[model samples]
Target chain A: MDDDRPLFFHVMAYADDADHDVIDMVSGDPDWEPPTALREGLREFADAPVADYQYPPSEGRGDLRDLLADRHDVPVERLVVTNGGGEANHLAMACGLEAHAGNEVILTDPVYPYYADRAELLGADVTYAPVADDGALDPETVRAVASEETALIVACSPNNPTGAVYGESVKRELTDIAEANDALYVSDEVYEAFDFSGRFHSALAFDSENVAVTNSFSKAMATTGLRVGYAILPDHLVDPVRTRHMLTNVAVTAPGQHAALKALRETPDDYYAETRAMLESRIEHFCEALDAAGAEYIQPQGAFYVLARFDGFPGTLDNTKRLIDEAGVAGMPGDAFGSAREEWLRFALVSPRADEAADRLAAYFS
Target chain B: MDDDRPLFFHVMAYADDADHDVIDMVSGDPDWEPPTALREGLREFADAPVADYQYPPSEGRGDLRDLLADRHDVPVERLVVTNGGGEANHLAMACGLEAHAGNEVILTDPVYPYYADRAELLGADVTYAPVADDGALDPETVRAVASEETALIVACSPNNPTGAVYGESVKRELTDIAEANDALYVSDEVYEAFDFSGRFHSALAFDSENVAVTNSFSKAMATTGLRVGYAILPDHLVDPVRTRHMLTNVAVTAPGQHAALKALRETPDDYYAETRAMLESRIEHFCEALDAAGAEYIQPQGAFYVLARFDGFPGTLDNTKRLIDEAGVAGMPGDAFGSAREEWLRFALVSPRADEAADRLAAYFS
Candidate 1:
């Protein structure tokens, strides 16, 4: 029942082999310009002294960590710069399992698949708590499923696929629930910058020791290829996470961090606002096409994904391939996430051709 | 008895806190300039299209993987580019344990600490096979430790601390031993480019499915900060390793891989030869100081470390700290490696101040 290969790669390979021109909506890689200062930083770092090319501190470059600490309003000791938000999440899960008494991890249904995959890789028993129909994970639902055996509870917001941004009350209650259950809550905020909803709230705002906030510049800075991210941990988890990070990755890319620092320092709020405006327009256009096709879709409140279900067209591996072949568009089948979303399909509005892809889908269905 | 902290960071922290000038001999981070072409590549990539700043293939950039596969004389399917040799080794060990029936891992005594740390982190039972006094692991010693329950056997050639390069015969026999024991042999060849003696041989020369060779450009290209490395896995292990890499790191840094690719394509043989020549001279000069100080030392056969023992100054943590405060030189306490070499201190000679540091050490002891 388990396909060890990630869903994105499986569908992507099929897309690559398609004879027709396929507009890719399956991958979350943003196809926008990165901050200009990031490129300038890369060029500048090409002339950095030899020591800068040797090794940054395992935790991270001092200045980058300091900047992240300032931004997050956490002490510098609470941060660890990672290879990406991927490694940050990996470290959090591993550390959570190690520190807690139980080997079980609680994840939201219609989950980001990597959370479940990583929990399994670290030998945790995973149990899913189904999200509400609106794609919001209720704290009560988490509390219902979580037991003393739950070592970790992982949630993402602004969420992937569903794009439901958890509000302050919801995040606070989830943190409290995890703390009561002796579980660590790993909140992936990688898409935080994409939140269009005013309700988006970080678990860090709750100031709970159980929460680890994982974020990356991949989505926000439009530079996933750079592979720079960080985990802001509770004081207790810092050392173990740092050591695990060191053993697993040694350190993040020096030049990437340098570029990220430059971008963070120099990129104006207008750049982010413009990006959000761009995505909002794409979302509006795509949702209109969905209406024309008579497909039911969750209008994303935050991240750049829309989950939709077309009547009589179940989102399965075969159907995903069919869409690539017949409709000239690619998307992730809902079953790739979890059982709760098996009849749905997820499309990332990352490509500039999002409108064209949406129109094609509308025409194919109509 | 477990400190949970890596020894390097512990000592390096003390070194950093020292008020006097301290020649850092504790870190293996090379001080040489990376290939000139690498800087050129970084500058060139600053102008790459937006797509290039998005995610590369999870396995790695295709051209970099192809180049590595060709260089190693392995099929492209055998390669999994990683964050560094650290992650490559972590993958090999984890995969080895998963694929084998046993949970026990055999490691060389005086081991690279990360090997043991990672094994424990993965919940494997670790046993040490002591190397010979000259710091060479005899195949028979490994054979003595092998059992049906042995999942992995790890070794490093041009070894850390001891600097003994294993020859072809020893490596071949080691592979045969692992195969006979139904175990995987992970050979860390990160220092392959630093072999000062003509004795260094990669376990890949044996062409055994039991062998996985891990290497990195961190040492060879002198760019540890770039975070680029790969593991040449046996056919059965590649898929699992690749999946683990994706879940853990997503992908290596695109810019770093681009730079590494350019350096690989353009670097002259003379560049490597000159590096080896420079290291050989340092080894010679450092050994001369050891003789003058009337200390016993293992003259390095390869790599850039010298393991030495003074008459009364044991390589304990206290003495290591004392050296930093008094002698103004920082070297790792050998006890940090493993119990087998607790009386010795390991000094990495990557600093341009290597001769001066050696002189300081000799005068301090005299």
Candidate 2:
């Protein structure tokens, strides 16, 4: 179903009209420099006589596949290039779930709407397993929700909204649950590089045949505009994904692909470390500000979001509109993430003005 | 299912060797400069702040859609954003062909392989209707091939491989055939700007419930690597296609979309005139060369491809291999296009080196 977000746009427009100094904390884009290498790569691509300016292989250029494979620690043949992890996840759910028309997808509750929305759009049944009080999935709970009619198990590690990275043991348990039920686990690891507490687990890392991993340059690389990502598919699924991607994009843009290839090849561990450092500091600042203000919240472990429960103002139903009307600061409403709790607001730690944003948010809650 | 490109990798490896001056004429990318306004728009965008780098509206950017709607003489709400026409076609096919196990696709023979391959991959029963002499469809032929079980009729105008733009009467016949048979007509007009003799009829221009149009920038703007195309689909089909596209690509790359918007908005008639002139000139030069070279061929009226038949070689199976090895010139084997006349070779008019290149081919044949 269409997410119907010109609704949010009207909110953004109203927020813009406010004369007060504004802090937009609802934005998902991380406040960080895209790696210098990525910049050079894009510039080089723009200048190159042919940075994939000619036709790329229908499946994708080998350099891209090889890099993706190495990163995933899989065979080069296991990867199929995609427009982004969105497509990767979409393809997996669309193609992998073909065995059953009404197969269930055990989506994490309070989830990235995409997880459930894509499944529904593809005509599959959805079973959202709400996060436990600890902000994590208990394997048994997931197992209870899945069924013989469940064709795919999808998870976002270093989860969106909550930023809870699945621990390895939990992932293994989920893997077993999927295996026992003959279900495919599709894990989105788009935010893997932002594991602030370092306990990131890939569902693919737990199992092979029943798991597919999808990743993208959107968050970690600060290249959301490029729309580059891929699925580390199981061998049998590669051809299907390739056909889908090719039939969809033909290939990603030449310049974007070159930039992606270059970024993947030359990314420094320090770049990720520096980014984590910034987010960690922002998280601490936000947590302290909220704590001082006596606001209820869950501190994010990874990803650049902090979910906090506000008593009277739970951010904005229309992104940033409520904040502009009342708080003078903007945040994503908990309702946006499909959380049962309607009073939670998300503060993006990626905003450069985190301290100012946090203070404004605290002031609003007060 | 993989398009069975058995010798695909071999040709790429051969191209990579750089030891010889191998001419790559097999690629469908025509040689032309992007419209100046498109470039100017990109320059403006490059200078604009990074805000445009954020998410696009699900319906597509309003400005681009407004212009596109104006160009098509359609209403703005009637349009939906797409990654490109490829996806528009795929989603339209998926939506048009309801959920079923054994749906069928009526494919034009020696046609664009993507239609047949994708339909097959999606589990549609792909049946072929032979392209008539001059690469146009006969109403009777389409009427004869359509079955009650058929879902999508994949039609390309100013057709690929064979450069014959289908006429309005033929489209009318095909439309009636699809309507009578309860099938959707998916039209690919990726080469809309290059109707060399000026007869590009959009199926949408006619009575259109079953007709959807797909087009791309690769051929028109000589930006093959940009990988941007879109479709103008029927109203009821909008949400399904939009959801599929958004789910496929979180969105097309911002810059590419920006560039495309600029191209359509800013590009002048002369820019198109020049592009047309270059292709028209190239077609003329090549045709004259082919006549002198004593090769039998279908004279192309539009699109940058000419199908030439070699008498000495009975099929392209040998001619393609021989041309690559002996002449170092590459045009796809006619068999690749599924023409019954296997001796024919499909030469993309992308290379301006036709004069010398034609001589080499003529000499090889002699």
Candidate 3:
């Protein structure tokens, strides 16, 4: 309803320009450094020859694709390297829309704004399937909206804004619905590695012919700015995806791909375990504080965000700004996400100082 | 018309698989290392904090934008860093089409295939104005095609495929026509530093509100894989470009922006001079051999490609494949560029062994 609602990045910038001592619970970016091996790879790439730094094979370098394919247990032909998860999702929608010859894309309400915005930008109509009360999908509701004109249905697991991790049953239903409707399913799994719920099931786990799963190294490797991400598509979609990719971003940055590959190969199992443990601990710490302050919020099952209800102020934007000015903390306004989220504020637990941030907000509410 | 023709990269890969000692004249990638400072900057960035590798300000890093602004003598608000010259051009067209709400985009005949493909991909109609026999733009011819529905006029000077460096008068005429028709002029100057004619001028040099100039460090720094390029937009167009960029690629890779900034700041003047000199020598060597072999070709005024007429074979694809199979050389077919040039083959002089390759061809012809 509020298309003119300012994006969180703009609000963050405005708060930053105000020059207050603000604690950032607003941004999705991790404050932790990437693995040492990944950083080291940058140096190695720098010292390589001109051709190494020149334009890569447009699909991607064979070695990196091989690594990705092996990791995903899919053939290299199914993957196309992209600028980030952003481009991967965009290409999937483009390919899906073309293949189905459809004009409409289906997204979940309280959606990741980028998905809704990009679909519109690409000249496709968007219809939302409202999230269930617990922030999980009800497959029947999604099915009701599907039609011959539906090109794609996008699902995010360990979802943004609300951290509900969709389980195997839900993912299967989504895959089935897409197949029955002749629409493609785009699974945004960039946050898959952050699933606190051990029940997280990949759409790839379904191994369905109509599903395309997109992931990025940003969240897992802590290198969001490097812009290396990819999609593993069904056999039928590869040609169109690769063609669109070649005409769009070409290939992801070479050094970033090199770094991601290094991180993938060398990052110890303990590293993920430890990072997940840290995020889980922070979520608990923040949620406990919210409880103590009598704040209403959903307990996260996966990912690092908490959607806390704060209807005291005029609206989400006003509440978010007031928090920034008064509590010296910044969080994303719910209205910026969707009309349904207007009474909630989404806080990211990406800061190393998450404890202090929670204390400040708790004190303000108390 | 044959959009299905194999790209040179595909042919090159096939040749490599055939295990021939191929002299690669197919790829337009420069065969020189990037500036030492830029590579060294990568190492520095690798050692920086997590914040350095996190998502940058969506448009770009402020420092890089500020530097670009100062270099171009424009305000920081006018620039948007992109994945590469590819994305910059894509965004320029997207912004132009939206602003004019028009369906048609104009490209020159014998055009870079990417522009035509991307325009069509974005759902805009494409019309071509033929380049003069010498490969330069004819102002009157272009003016005749400018209609109310012409949302964009794309010009690539020091042109790809043809290597024509448009002079000041023609560029002025283009800007005037665009302004008179309320159309946008997108000047792609990625090859700006490769101008050998000493007659090159940027559309930005015109200081018109209708012109948006896009450039990249790929050609000059030989860092095409780094995915960093920027566009200088008119003040009014900046918001649209910025919004489109945010929805599309998010931001250029962080390490790349850093590396490019270093290259922009510290590249010695002689690096460009030496590269130009090397290319000039290669062109002379190749053209001289062609003369001896009785081959007819357009002598490149700028850029690295020479469109040589080689109608000896049944078609350009046949000629190209035969050259690879027999002479152990690779090149792009003219049909890959446009139907009018199907009688020609495009050779890139970016190889260090350009002279030897030319000699091999000359001997084969004799």
Candidate 4:
């Protein structure tokens, strides 16, 4: 079946085509400088030998994979460099479905839409387990829905749209539930670098063959255009996913990987700290404007998103468009996510214009 | 079912791990310089605005797509930029299967292994239509294999391994056969720029709604590591393939695309002519050496490969390894392509060391 989820590009296009000046909060693309080292890396690659521009190992560059594996406390064989977190998730889900003896995939309600879209694309029957009102996914909800037919269970933290970071116990319990059901637990940790709560726990911490952790440099490095990311898969899943990756994309971009490796190695810790501080300030300012408008909003504990519910302004597609035209602001309709958040609007606080977007929303609603 | 095709990496690894210096002829990666403008493009992008580092349109960069659309004489909506020709082929095949009401796919007997691997990966039943001894595919063979159950027929012009360039008449007839059987003809033209013979013709000339043409910058620009490619698809297949590509790759690399765009715009025609001339010389030199070894070889009319059958030695995995160890030369076992070429060895003539590899083979055989 075709994916019925909202196309992000359509909303972005609407805002672009609007007559008035609109502060875009609909896109998750970070409006910040990538690390200086990344720029240097690109320049360095320009001078590399011709042979260096040929095919790299399909798995990834050995130095980069080895470095990542060391950082994650896993062997090099357990990881694969992918085109982006998108492909990483796709690979994990496809391999999970192939390895397990089932066709059903359990996902969180108010989920990141791509996860649901990928599950459906892979021909998995999807079942949603709704999270609590504050966006915390209770492992109990997952346990209640899981069955023998459940081939995969996908969870993201700090979660997109809602930004609830899963702690160690929650992650361990989710892994346990997946193992109990003979299913693979796919953990999307692309926002790991954005955790403000300090509660983010990687699924890799759990020593189980049932867990696959996917992450991307796009979000963390603020270089979404680079298309470099990876998956840390379990032992049994490694070869299958690598083969699938080879057959699908051949290999990740060699220059991108070269630049990523340079950035990963040379970027200072203070650079990340400064980014976190900047986003934390934007989040506080935006939440104040929401309070002024008398809107109920979840102040994200992690990640750069705020989910708000304005009375009499349910987040439907029509209203989302109306906000772009009349309010001079653009945010995603909550219905684009699952039913649980259908009455809310999700704004990505990645743009430097977050404050301007907040002011417009406050004024229009008032 | 899992693909049982020979892993190209394993062979390359064996050659790499060998004690002596080996002349590698197994990989099709070109050992030539990319357009000089590409390097300048990468350097220029290093100083680009911060906003440019965010996600590009998932389909591709707009300017690049428009340029390609104009060149191919297709509507921009009918084109999609992909990670590589590999993904372009994957998308075309998947969409073809989804659009048609059938499970069987017809392929060339000595096919590029990845096409068969992908068909099996997509769960399509594969049937082979054998090519003639000289590597010309007859439309009649495809017609004999076609039925109500066939969904797709794949063909490659300037074919890999065998290097057969399909002319206009053959392409038109193949497209006619596919149309009559209600199957999509997925024509891979990745080696479009490598055609030395005047016989090569694009399937796009047939003006059929059931044909999809896939090509890549990897071969033409000698930039396999850049990972940029595209598919010119039929109207009905465009949206489905775009959605699938978005879910799978998010997008191709930004800097790579930026460089590709610059190279495409600024590189002179002489650059391509020089590359072709170099390959033509290597082909002549390599064939003479093969003849000295008393090997019956198909002298490639186009592309950078030659298939040769030695008198007593069959091309098997063991023999491929032995050549790497003893002769200090590496070539692909013909069985990797398909059963029809099992007794022959395929050598890629991309390396500057092609003459050295040919010399090694001749001396070893003598």
Interface RMSD of every predicted model, in angstroms: 1.7, 2.7, 1.9, 1.3
lDDT against the true structure, per candidate, is 0.90, 0.73, 0.85, 0.90
Error of 4 at B272 (Å): 0.7
Q: DockQ of every model listed?
A: 0.73, 0.49, 0.70, 0.77
Which one is best on TM-score? 4
Instruction: List candidate 3 segments past 4 Å from native.
Output: A1-6, A17-20, A311-315, B1-5, B18-20, B310-315
Which lDDT tens digits does candidate 1 get at residues B1-366? Answer: 243255777888889988889999998899998999999999989999999998888898899999999988989999988998888999999888898779888988888888888888788999898988888778898888799999999999989868989899889988988899899999999999999889888888788999999999999999999999999999989988987887888789999989999999999999899999999998898899898889888878999999999989999999999999999999999887888989999999999999999899889988
Better of 3 and 4 by TM-score: 4
List fnat, each candidate.
0.88, 0.53, 0.84, 0.85
| Alpha-carbon TM-score of each model against the true structure | 0.96, 0.90, 0.96, 0.97
- Write the residue-wise lDDT of candidate 4 on A130-162 in tens digits: 988888888999999899999999999999989
Query: Candidate 1 — which residues are off by over 4 angstroms?
Result: A1-6, B1-6
Q: Write the per-residue lDDT of candidate 4 for residues B197-226, one digit (tens) a residue.
A: 978888988779989999989999999999
lDDT of 2 by residue, A251-351 (tens): 76666677778887898888888888888888898998898778787767788888887555555565357576666776666766775545777666766
Q: Candidate 4: misplaced stretches above 4 Å?
A: A1-7, B1-7
Ranked candidates, highest TM-score first:
4, 1, 3, 2
Candidate achieving the largest DockQ:
4
Candidate 2, residue A118: the lDDT equals 84
